[model samples]
Target: MFSLIVGLVVAVVLIVLNIVLSKLSFPKEGRILAILVILVGYIYWGFEPFAHHEMHPHVEHASYSFDGKQDIEALEHAGKDATEIKAFWATIAKIAEHKGDAVAGKALVTANCTGCHSIKSEGFPEIMSDADAAASYGVTPPDLSIAGKVYDKNYLIAFISNPVKAMHIEHKYPVGGEKVFPMPASDFMQPQEIADMVAYLSDAAQKVPAPTVKKGASEFEISKAVNKEVFETACVRCHAMNYAGIHAKTTAEVMSKYIGATPPDLSQYIRSRGEEYLHNFINDPQRKLSGTGMPRVGLTEKAESQVVEYMTQIGDSKKDEREALAPKVLIYLTILAVFALLWKQKIWRDLH
Candidate 1:
């Protein structure tokens, strides 16, 4: 839980003490104590196997202009669809070069996407109901009302061009794999067409009210519902958390067909995977597990944090209690250590 910082700090202190002790002569009875300190320091930073460097996990993270740095989208370099990687990159470049016509995009949306989706704010209701859509496509299609606002624009552009490339799931594109993606790639549409649809969506989404900041509600409000909305919107489409009474719209079997395996219920993930891991994984699935069926979900930092907090609330109900008791437990241990040291000194005094 300390993330090895305490261990490293203790090692450093012992190393410094070791240097000072090396210059002094310890009493014969106390010589073993100095040796023990040196041995502990060696284990902390030394004693690596010959291939430790090679086998150690090289956990790397990729960033984008979304992180407020520059315009490098990490997923742009991920899975390619056959020999079309070059063309896909060029399409992305073209999409960036061109500005979309929102009005024209609205028409393109009517012609192309409204069969599965709905933009009620723009007077386009879903052609298929959730039940009907689920039966036909194995999962209900999401409303595009806020897609432009919530999703990363670059990701949206790439996803519209080719989902297989935007999401690193080329493994599922083979002959026997789940080749039936509900949202087909808009191969008939050029880069301009793709941008226009996104533009219409982006333009339309502005009409819908934005999601709450949620941090204040999670803290002072403590309603739990406010914090959980992020998880519901971002995660509930695919994964279920049965313990939290959150079920996926699609059945487990159908979800397996979509992603090669049914996504695991995220009930006990707070226990199995800590908050740090959840943050990284939620931000970008490929960052933690490359080629995962899960896409980047494209949540802001606040939304992502809310999901973690929701998970903590559901799965880690004891967190507050545990935190309150931690200091008392540490205090007891410190007192016991002090007593042990005094007893050791008393015995040594008698021996000397």
Candidate 2:
């Protein structure tokens, strides 16, 4: 449009110059200049539609989002956005619908939280601190699990966006120390981003169990009980499913003695010892069952009993049954091998 106006103005100036020059008797040069200006204006007018702005036409489509919605309709579907970019638009759809965007929330967490607190292949705190809330970062990163139990969506967003609003006397840190650690104020986060992050955190937090209390003990019976309690309190941190396998290292000895390498069958111990003995072993494994990596579990007698009762009562898979099933597994593998060989050499390959 600007070019068109400029071309018109130039054409008018050329015409006026031509008239003036003709009156002054320089007709030939003036006519040439006027014709050039008119030609330029015609070219500009012909290309006027291209002057609006260089915008590629847009196309739209349907896609999925991490905000718990699927197959959201998309506007402006054109672009190299069909791959991972689709995830971003799906998040936009959720925000449009007033639902929270967890994928974007995860990005926010990676940007903000990963430096301090992280989960397996997820986000920060590369190594965890063994010390309690009395340690650094002032207050421990609250187990995101159950955060929503204590905090509402608005409360979480507000606290995360600017914790100073919630950082009054009762919530004040320092606990008698000189240093005061507080959540950093973020003008960096968008209001909707904060909302999405809070929503994501709330959902993530809900998947985790509540924090448990640990108590100390010394005797074997007490130690096993403590071990059980410790398993609940501390061991669960590294070992999921009562040390069945989660993060535990497999023993080559067990495999050499039996089949290859696998975790020892713990189902037998739980059944034979009747939970109490196992609890003691757990409480103080070094003292009671020396030369093992099992850490001492500081457990109160009541906590030990609770742990004992829990193990004995729980209907876990039986070791004997699993062992018995092993032969059947071997037989299935043998049959599969025979069939595969027959299929390859005798029939299927030739058919193909």
For each candidate in the order shown, give its overall lDDT on alpha carbons. 0.71, 0.47
Question: How many pairs of residues collide in each model?
Answer: 0, 24
C-alpha positional error of residue 257 in candidate 1 after TM-score superposition, expressed in Å = 2.6
Model 1 spans with C-alpha error above 4 angstroms: 1-56, 65-83, 120-131, 175-178, 210-227, 279-291, 295-306, 317-352
Over the stretch 279-345, how does candidate 1's per-residue lDDT look in tens digits? 7777767767877878666665656777788888888877888999999999999999999999999
Give the alpha carbon lDDT tens digit for every residue of 1-352 in model 2. 5655776786687678656756775568666776677677666655764443333222221111122122122223333334433454344344344567787887887677655555432334444553432144433344343343334453355456445322222123324544344457564666677767767776775555433334553333453443353343433332334343333222233223221223333434566654544654654443333344343333334444555554543323444467799999999999999999987877766787
Best by lDDT: 1
Clashing residue pairs in candidate 1 (N, C-alpha, C atoms within 3 angstroms):
none
lDDT of 2: 0.47
Q: Which ten residues in a row have the lowest lDDT in candidate 2?
A: 62-71
